[model samples]
Target: MTDWKKIRAEFPALENWIFLNTATFGQLPKRATEAVACHFARRDRYACSDFMGWFEDADSVRATIARLIHAAADDIAFIPNACTGLSLMMGGMDWKPGDRIVTLEDEFPNHYYYPGYLAAQGVEFIETPFERFYDAINQRTRLVALSMVNYSTGFRPPLEEISGFLRERGVMLYLDGTQGLGALQLDISAIRPAMLSVDGYKWLLAPTGGGFIYVDSELRRHLRPNIIGWRSHRDWRNHENLHHGTPEFGTEAEKYEGGMLSFGPIYGMAASVEMMLEIGPEVIDERVMQLAGSVRDILRRAGGVLRADSDSLYISPVVTARFEEKDAGVLAHELKSRKVLVAARHGNLRVSPHFYNDETDLERFEAALKQVL
Candidate 1:
């Protein structure tokens, strides 16, 4: 059984407030914080020591992330944020005048605007209503990019079906998984998207600027390195060969990694990933879904209107509902005043519960809602 109480103890922030906003930013576990501090201390010990060990650390972190997504280690790369990954994907692809890309309207701006940036290369962007997003893809479409979960409403998309449909037409699929990665169990092997990017700050419970990108092995060759840095070469550490000819391009997804690695945040992310794996993704998924479902039930019984699909259990731990006669922003403030933390987005109260949150947390949240409503 998953011991959520033990897990909660690992996150010091949870002890103070009911942090139901894992969708916005997750609370870093104490272990990750300590790991970051340790890395900083190590750096202080040897200011100019060889950085090869840090590269190895980055490799190991990518390997762990590969296991989490069920992808080959060589197929993943470290990026500072999800936008960089999306930009690399969009910029690497060849585009022609009138070429169309399809995506949803309410997507996070980073995911939305990168395709529009591609539009400046003479590509056209088409936004379909999220409900009918699949219907908009056609022969003229070159790529389909979307968030796996709506950040605001917590709507989980049908990733498998969309991937299948896009694959049949030879259109690439890019998924932004920021809202769903750690909170949901997603098998990227089954989804088979061309590229999937996730930032660790949100559901992954790591510090900001720690994120990863996944590219299918076959698609790796099709992408050119968007940013050039000395570290992107295959033999980047050989400082003795300063006058050597241009270094050979990296053989795998390492080509996407540009510039010196950020060892501190990367180490922190590695610790967070290890902790999540120790708890088991399946167990975390089950516990979070159960708590979110219970919270949804409580809200519905209190006459709140649910904006997400009521029957779908695959939704993210984030749940949202609208009160009939109250301002969602005001209700959110009221909940916060009672030591409950939730976000108000798009006229609904966004309640996101993580693994550390327990039934008692839900009860406290419900009692606060009762008072607010």
Candidate 2:
């Protein structure tokens, strides 16, 4: 068994505050911050003297992300964030006028933003509840975009069932793993989605402005490289001399990275992911669910909470509770003032505890929540 108390010590930010808000942002591990600071420290001592080292770090991190998701390193593209990664894939697809896009009702805005633009080009954008999401997929449906775990209600969709169904129908499945990636186990072999994007900040315990996308080889014909630059080409080597001309971009997912990368964040992300791999993904998942489940029970026993409604079938680490008499934003502020941080989303209170959180954090939250209620 893993010593979760030692794991919890990795996050110094947890020392002073009760942080159960991994859904909005995760507390960066001390090693990640140190790695980032070390990179800049080297820069301070010497200019771009170690340019090759940056490329090496980026490539190694790519391989690390591949191991995390069970994909080929070449198939992974480092992205600025999940939204940018999704936009890159969406831009590449050969969308026709009548092509239809189906997504969930309350997804992070990326789902609606990209499809909203496609709507002007005569593409049908259908937003429905998870219950009717399957029925919405007709012959005209080109893609099914959704979150692996819902951000608002903490509902996890049946990816195995949905992926197999879409595979039989030859439809594409675009998944956003921001809320699920590091907390849950996601094997590409099981889902086989056409494309998946994730943010490294939340759950992954990395800094902002870093993420990745996994593009399937089967979608090569449909989704061409819509964005490119010097680093995007297959022969983008430019250590001694710059090579430029009519560049040839490969069908690998890296073709969408239009420019240079932020190496500091790259190193930070590598450190964070390495920490997670050491702890074991399954171990982390089990711990997170255990804490969130305990949180739900506490909320239940406390009383004074209303049922906006909940689906207990497929649940993730995100635990949400509704209080009809209390405003969620006010409650969140009150909790934060008491040094207990949580999030209010779409009129519901969303609390997400990670592997670093301990039972003490839960007890404090339980006390704070009761006092606020």
Candidate 2: stretches off by over 4 Å? 304-310
Q: How do the predictions measure up, each by TM-score?
A: 0.95, 0.96
Stretch of 10 with least lDDT, candidate 2: 304-313
- TM value for model 2: 0.96
Model 1, position 364, has a per-residue lDDT of 84
Please, what are the lDDT tens digits per residue for candidate 1 over residues 263-339? 78888888998998999988888888888889889888888888655546235677888887999999989888988
Which lDDT values do the candidates have, in the order given? 0.83, 0.84
Q: Model 2: per-residue lDDT, tens digit, 228-269?
A: 677766777664565667667766677778678888878888
Cα lDDT for residue 116, candidate 1: 71
